[model samples]
Target: MTVKPGSIHALLGGNGSGKSTLIRILAGVERADAGQIDIGGAQFAAHSFNAGLAQKNEVHVVHQHSSTFPHLSVAENLSLGRGYEASIGGRILWPTVRERARRVLARFGIGASPDQLLSSLRPAMQTMVAIARALQDQEGSATGLLILDEPTATLSSAEVARLADALRRYAAAGQTIIVVTHRLDEVLDLADHVTVLRDGKVAGDLPREEVTHETLVQLIAGNSLPVSENRGQRRLAGRVLLQASGLCVGPLANMDITLGAGEVVGIAGLVGSGRTSLLRALFGLSRVSAGTMLFDGAAYGPADPADAVRHGIAYVPEDRLAEGTFPGLSVVRNVSMANLDRYWKIARLRTKAENRDAAAVADLVGLRPRRTDLAINQLSGGNQQKVVIGRWLLRKPRLLLLDEPTQGVDVGARADIHRLVRGAVSEGASAVVVSSDFSELAELCDRVVVLNRGRVIADVTADELTSDNLQQLAHMRIAA
Candidate 1:
């Protein structure tokens, strides 16, 4: 697929559909076996492209998890890529660096101070900082190609709009952009031209006017995906399995929520709205300083994750790469790690039993490659997520806490994950899912707890839940 100059080209595909590989090749992180690459009027054999060559050709990329230093100041992060302003005496000029950073931030409409820590900003602002840093040397010119991978995956709707506006301004100024994302709405809203990839080949290419959400999904999946049957009729009528009253954890203030047995409840809120905090608190990652919790008709408060696990609670964190999977461990080990006691026989680990159980869990989660011996890190984002979820599913936890379970996974993997979660819920497990994707909440949840500034603003029932309505509620500010 060819990207036109001065256009916002969207690269769409499922997991392992070669989108990441293609991006890596363009960014010079990976060598292509046999292909040709053309940037501007220059052509190079794909195998010959390297980091140095990509840099010389002015190709800049901001990955899904940006490589910005959180502990450092924005000025420092911006200066790291492009060298610092130094004097003849070899001393770094702090004032010059700050001024340049301010200029770049303003040019990109980023509302962040140069002296502020990169981590201090919200997810969207941090993303804008990364984008500004990527284009700092270009000075708003149209000379370089900017590639952003899954930039809006973790951002809220409002945050996504903010970033989309910035990108549109950049594209309007002739700065060419290629956005590789799993978000269909982003493609519909931001892309000038769309290219869908399937199994490492271009599936379809269409202009923005010719693209709809349905058409895009069809192209990405290589066929029309089955519409999820309406689950709104399934109301929360089961026994309350987990209930929290006046819950107070980090960023969570006086929040109250109830989860029914065999129910999937979604936590909806913008960044800093305590969506993840609720999950962490429930999973015993955070202490509830002031609250009353009831688990299965008993007063419950887990001291830690192990205690929670003993009480049949499982958590899947948002940043799967950093928090979920063990890098060098095999899928079997990862799956069995949560419940090692199940395989402990007379003080000796039962390897065969562990592998047997892990294989069953892998099949249940529909893990790709169907190999339990491969390192969990070797799998794609979706497959890695499946492994992580499968690991927890092996425990048959009573309460499942999922934070952005389908954040970066492809459409097919997402459906598979939803199916797995629903199947578990059907078998007497309850779930509390925290997600920025409103549509996901609408699809998988029987009820939604909407948070605003750490307060429970709305408890939307299934009949009233819709993606658009959830987005609105998340952005609303109710008077205390």
Candidate 2:
């Protein structure tokens, strides 16, 4: 694969399709087994390229997490990888650092003050700060090959547009960029060229004018149908399973939601829109200051996660690596961790029974390699998510609260997970899903509840559900 100078190139692929691995190789975070790299008429062996070489070649990277210290000022964050200006007496030159930060922020159109804490800015502005810091040279000019991984994943639609415009301006000024993103609309609007990876290989490479949304999806997913297809056939049982009335929690105002038996309800919102807060409140991770909840025709207010579990509620958090999985443990242990009491018999753990149940769940989730003994971290992001969801499926809870269940998974694995959720619901369970991906919510949910500043502005049924509609509703401002 080749990237031309002075062009915005998009690196497109499904999860586990070699996108992250390739990015790591280019950024010198990982060594490639065999390959050659060409940078500005210079050639180097891929294996010999290290962080030092990448820096010397003007290669810079900004990750999805932004890699910024929230508590630190914007000037401090900009001065991180690069050294600070120091006086002859070894005192740091604060004015010099702030001046340099101001120039870079202005050049990138980032609406952030140099002295302001990074956490004080909006999510989009924080991402722009990271990008500006990466692309800015010592001369305060954008003059390098910048690579960004999922930079807009957390931003709202309007914020994404602003960032895309900044990138376009940078590319026009002869700065080469490689953007790794899952959103196809971003590729169409921002990229000059596109390279797609599938199963660790280049599946397609096309010019921007030659690519369309359908063609890109076909390249990334191959022949497998999208999970969104066949949404018309799914039917929800006409019985309410869970209900919340005037629910008030952190960032959540008088919100009301109802989940039907064998139904999947989606919560759609921007950052801090109370999507995750709703899930946490239901899972008993957050205290509900006011309001009432009913589950299966009974008043339900779980004191804690253990209490929620005892009451037959399961929650899959948004950050799977941080909250869902035990990194070093085997798939079997991770799957059975939530329900260990089932294997405890007479003060002795029933290893065989645990393994048997885990294996069944692995099969149910279509876990690749079919090895329950493998470490949970060994699996790809998609499979790791599968293991996390499988853990909840093993217990067969009455109401499942999934926060971004398919956030970083591949198309195939996403379909598998959606099928698994639908199957569980078909067996009389109910689900409340929170996802930033509007398309996923439109496809997988029977009804979508749109939240803005913690209030339910719209509840859209499946017949009226579409990615565009969800986005429009979430961005709408309603008078209090």
Candidate 3:
């Protein structure tokens, strides 16, 4: 429970491990029942758990999703807490606020204009603004603590590196920082002290010197994880299930892909490299202006997702929360949404039969809580992803398209998902997986296809799939 001053501390845990709850208490978003918090020797009682009280104690939190107002300018967002320079009647001075914003932005190395709209900036810049706003008050510099929750979850690798560099600089300047992240690599790269939480209690605490990947995984899982040495087992190429020639979708040009039955193919690319676009094109979510596709010896161009689904094709979108799930729906309904026809009998919906089948698939997918009646939003991010992927299992899809399948998933659930996908592929279903994690692609795919500027650069077999190789090929510059 002791956090050293002027140090970077990382909090690691599995889903539902109370890491977020502990952070909320610190951030003044939640109240503690009994215990007191000692920040720089200043004791905060349970009753003093509000935003103003937390701010007075010099505690600030930057959430995973930025809370910056899209319509407001950067200067306005940065000056929200500490209002603008005002006259006797509280008349604000716009010039003073803009000047303050410029200084803050410059201090954080964020190359953005104070007058620029928050929505116009990229994700990384918006995160920078969030941090800059948190660090606005100079009066409590020595006593301040910055709490970041999963800051790099949606950032690209380069953006993460930049954020890490900024944090290191802040720590060097005697600022205390607490970061909650599931990415082990980020913890190792940016933290000086590490604490692992399990089931609402501290499982292990260690100095950065003593924490390793295997040790952390063991602490999080409460046991040693199985290390599979037999990786990338090559599958016998089956009959050609999908063939795309000269495909053209948004940001995708002349992309050619050949997928065989029972084979798993991985698509590797950087952000905006048309990875998601290609998957959407195949799933009929995006319009393919020019392309010829052959599916099962027939010309296959689906008019929409319904047509694609009817043709035995399933798509699990990249943004699971936004696109792949309905939060208001029950777990059973979400699980059976892709195949409602199977539950129809005599023009009446079979509710009991649907729940029964959904519960079975939920069990197979290792969904936590194992409750069919609860709303999908009640589950954790990992379990929600499981529901989205599990829904397709009942369809017995001929072609499965997955994008960033394990983005927010935990370590154990990630393994279960990989097993489920591979099991389906083994049962003669073709799969196309798009992932930014090259290691995931190497482990799950029989072949890896690298894309750069919407063009295929390399087609690598399972044996040749390595993180370094995939990274290099996906980032390699192609001549126009």
Instruction: Put down candidate 2 lDDT per residue, 28-57, tens digits, no spaces.
Output: 889999989888887989998888788888
**lDDT for residue 166 in candidate 3, whole number 0-100:** 83
- Give the higher-TM-score candidate: 1 or 3: 1
- Runs of candidate 1 exceeding 4 Å displacement: 224-281, 286-294, 299-307, 316-321, 324-480
Using lDDT as the yardstick, the better of models 2 and 3 is 2
Give the CA lDDT, 0 to 100, for residue 163 in model 3.
84
Against the true structure, whose TM-score is highest? 2
Q: Candidate 3: which pairs clash? A: none
| Candidate models: Cα lDDT each | 0.85, 0.84, 0.83
Each candidate structure's TM-score, on Cα atoms with residue i matched to residue i, is: 0.63, 0.65, 0.61
Off-target runs (Cα >4 Å) in candidate 2 are 87-90, 138-142, 225-239, 243-281, 284-294, 298-311, 325-397, 402-480
**Cα deviation in Å at residue 411, candidate 1?**
18
Tens digits of lDDT, candidate 3, 1-480 = 779999999998765678888988887888888788887777778656777778888898999877888889999999887678878899988898889889888877888999999999877778878988888776336567899988876676687888888888888888899998766767878899999998798999999999887677667656422324645467877899999999998767888999988899999976666899888988888999998999998999989999999889999999887899889999988887888788878999999989888888888898888998899999988889888888897788988999999987888878888888987887778899999777788778889999876788899984567655675566454554
Output the lDDT of residue 352, model 1: 92
Ranking the candidates on TM-score from highest down gives: 2, 1, 3
lDDT of 1 at 456: 87
Please state the error at residue 202 of candidate 1 in Å.
2.1
